[model samples]
Target: MKKSPRRTFIRDTAIAATGFFIVPRHTLGRGFVAPSDKLNIAGIGVGGKAEVNLPFAWNNGSDNIAALCDVDDRMAVKARARWPKAPYYKDYRVLLEKEQKNIDAVIITTPDHMHAVQALAAMQLGKHVYLEKPLTHDIYEARTLTKAAEKYRVVTQMGNQGSSGDDTRLVETWIQSGVIGEVKKVHVWTNRPTWPQGVPVPKGSFNVPAELDWDLWLGTAPQRDYNPAFLPAIWRGWSDYGTGSLGDMGCHFIDVPYRALKLGYPVSVECNVGSVYTGFFQEAIYYESYPPSSITYIQFPARGEMPPVEMIWYDGGMKPPRPAELQPEEQMGELDGGIIFEGSTGKLMAGLFGRKPTLLPLSKMASATLPKSAFEFVENGSDGHQQQWVKACKKGYGAYTSSSFDKSG
Candidate 1:
């Protein structure tokens, strides 16, 4: 593949960021050059979550944000302002083509459906990719992207930030130390309370914003009338653009237990969905949308060194029944999200989103001693997810959260 001019810029940025000694240009072997030098990065879908991660990418040592792309010009404006020197575009393809040589890696924070297409295109051109999670909208896309990453030999990282969290490491340690004993089942929940669940689609015709490119936003999804409800953040509840609440947070909430147990693809997945009918329909009343909630049951068969386990995911105002041993007062302070492990020896409860979990049945938890062999915490402080990607790209190091084609598929 003919490398683009952007490759030079990317190499320089990587070098500067890492303060690595640049190899003399005269010594460059036939085609090989040090991976680190400088890195030229591009941001896709510069709205919503993209806004949060874009700044981090820069902070992590991206020399220059070469391009900014988003369907909604309004959304891109903020990012453009932040990186005044970078060129901007409404379509990602145009950005990619124009900045082909000026860009080395692309950060995809687009809607779920567009992730695979845009990412695959970038990888085809040999650009490293840092994609937001669930990895892809559907299982197949996940599989395809994984294959592309391997084929291209491009550095890749999923947006599961928690995978790099200290709390997550703590959870892993606790499990490995036998603090939770043999886990047979786990329940995870998040307060995905958005619009009235179970409510019917709203009936209305509203003018689409001029700055918003509706068709591009729809992308591969079936076309539908413009609805403000789906825009911004509430789209997660809808089946089309977003992946219900489960897809939204599964990667984050379930990631800890998944890693601790070395979970693989689930054997079967069955959803106990709320009363939301199929077909293209918008919710009319907030309360009339989907039935205020649903629970998805995922069953995973035994993997190496791990036994089969049942995982229950709860969201949209639904919660698992409280353990009988806990007093009513003890449950009062519990937040809307968390995980509970039902082990053969005892039960353990953790705070929402993988906080260092505490043993349940307060009394027994206090008396129990954990095993000695466990990962010790070292203070490398700060959320280093973005930094990890930057270092990996510069050094050609493989990522810890790299999803496999088979597992994600």
Candidate 2:
């Protein structure tokens, strides 16, 4: 009888586990769970979103949580309490070196600036990586990581759960199958910067908190005295530490349209940021941070059979003009954000994550030519995205993932 690779590998792990070489539960504690099929995983940046992301990726203990690392002990409290047996460290470099033998994959939920460095470091050691969206802090780093993922021949996934959803694939089918003929323009908008921006860094005598490692938390970013202004979740508004609102939610917002249209690199891009007035004629010195609002235009060159495409991004509560085809009572998009693709025959609108996709005019759905999909495109939500990566990791390198560097980059 032929054995599937997954089952064969699990059998081997079970054999290895039952060997004379055994581990003491006392060392790893009662939390030590040795599931033969489980991948030994590490959690980097186990705070903020990582707090939530870890569970989704861990998938309720389907995978073993072997190690945990974070710069802030205060922020790490909940995670540490949850996985006490998983050794904790304040420094990723240290955790990588010490736990290198224990973990098979690394989940990176660090801030934008640290993403490239942490992910690159882990991948260099041949560990599979699950990194958050936007991929890296800059274009160069993003390109570098993309090449590294291929060169190292390791399984990788980007944390854009919307890409894994059924709505995303459905949108892809609708566009690819010509339901919306030749999209030439797209408008994406978000209501981000829910954190403060457009203001200069605050002034005060701030003390670095005892539970946090200020220097490590600011990895690759320029050094400054740690301040309360950037703590917990406010870093998204800062230019040095975070990617601002665009990087905060743009990846999720653009994933559907970009993939469906095959919109490659932009030919030309331009952007303008709104200014903040500091009373009188003076404007706030916010060059160090993104503005409260921004509008960007990206023009992509035509692909083989596709036409040149123009995509506009609006954030900070800005939105495009309401389509005339729709009645006044019809909703344009969710309060969070939405996207509209202007095609030759009609327009397609969807929520930020491609949810509730619809044809314009409310009446168009009646006559819209729905495409026949080869397979059902019904995947959606973050839980499925995390499990997708976990299962892919178990399947080894070259396994499929929805938003690997190839797609997300």
Candidate 3:
């Protein structure tokens, strides 16, 4: 059979649109080339959480890591072992300057303070970015990144993996189904184990790691002496380097109820802590890092068709009061992190990102039926949330929730 020129043109157009190309078996074999095809990814911070997430991006099929950047040479060496072909750099700007054209997107898993600067630089160069959550160190940075992402029209995904979970959608469906009719209030809590919480500042000077480029690591943050306790995961407890427990887990823990209730921006935010201590460390540490503990209350106004919602955010050692409806056997196990949606009819409680949710008031749970208009839970079936972003990057599909631009600001 002979193919018409028009058919050949249409096929090629489809291939191009999909960022894929089919080559003859004899030439390049029988495989389709992805659009945004053959992405060369780079890692901005290759320690802590980035180590876990970077691999997922590679496993997603559309990306291949091309560069790794970290202020610590030890961490960079660890990353290099994973992708020996990818070059390493102490400063991300150097990597961006040298490999900007070679890289398709940059995964920024750096500290919250650095997220805005690094992400803005990447997006300015027309590269897509995947930023870790709580988006930025401050509200201003969050808004700035959102605007930059929009201006560049780049694909962006925030590191809130729970947003892409099947359970999350189920909770959304449950809410929309009126299983918990007209959610009026929500109490979200997490007992984030302390890594550096409540620990007073080191009174003595310490030796800095020779492998660490301390200046680069500090970046826009105020300069400080090296302290072993402040590095690695402990940084989350500090205000300068991190966002405390709420900033650390709030995005993930609170995301479900926020999304389920279609929460708009909070009208006001106030913090009530046990005590305030004055020192160089207090300025460096977030309120959640202190002992005796604290709680932040965020109130959001009802907008459009939604009712006003009161959200009580608890963390740095707090737990929700056990619901009265649960039997001894039905009591939730180890309330590490979860949300309870209190509605007029019944209550819906679920773990972070909607994992293993159970309706309260067992009678209501038994009597209530799935809504007729409810959408079937369709698993996207990609490896995970990061993979979903890579797939979206290749296919030009809009970002899923946990999206960088949409969720960050």
Q: Which tens-of-lDDT digit does each residue in 1-409 have in candidate 1?
A: 2322332533432333233122212243211225656667889988888887778778744456778888898888789888888888877767776777677778899888778878877776667788887688887778778877776666787887776667677777777666767887998998875544455565699999999978677766766788888777676666666676777778778887887777877889988865554556833334423345779899998876567999999887788888886887786214658888888777777764467567778877567775442554323322566556655666552544333333344
Write the number of the candidate with greater lDDT, choosing between 1 and 3: 3
The TM-score values for the models, in the order shown, are 0.82, 0.88, 0.84
lDDT of each: 0.70, 0.80, 0.72
Cand. 2 TM to true fold: 0.88
Better-scoring candidate (lDDT), 1 or 2: 2
Worst 10 residues of 2 by lDDT: 17-26
* Best prediction by TM-score: 2
Order of the predicted models by TM-score, top scorer first: 2, 3, 1
User: What does the lDDT read for residue 12 in candidate 2?
Assistant: 43
User: Which candidate number would show the highest lDDT if scored against the true structure?
Assistant: 2
Candidate 3, residue 12: the lDDT equals 36
User: Roughly what TM-score does model 1 have, to 2 decimal places?
Assistant: 0.82
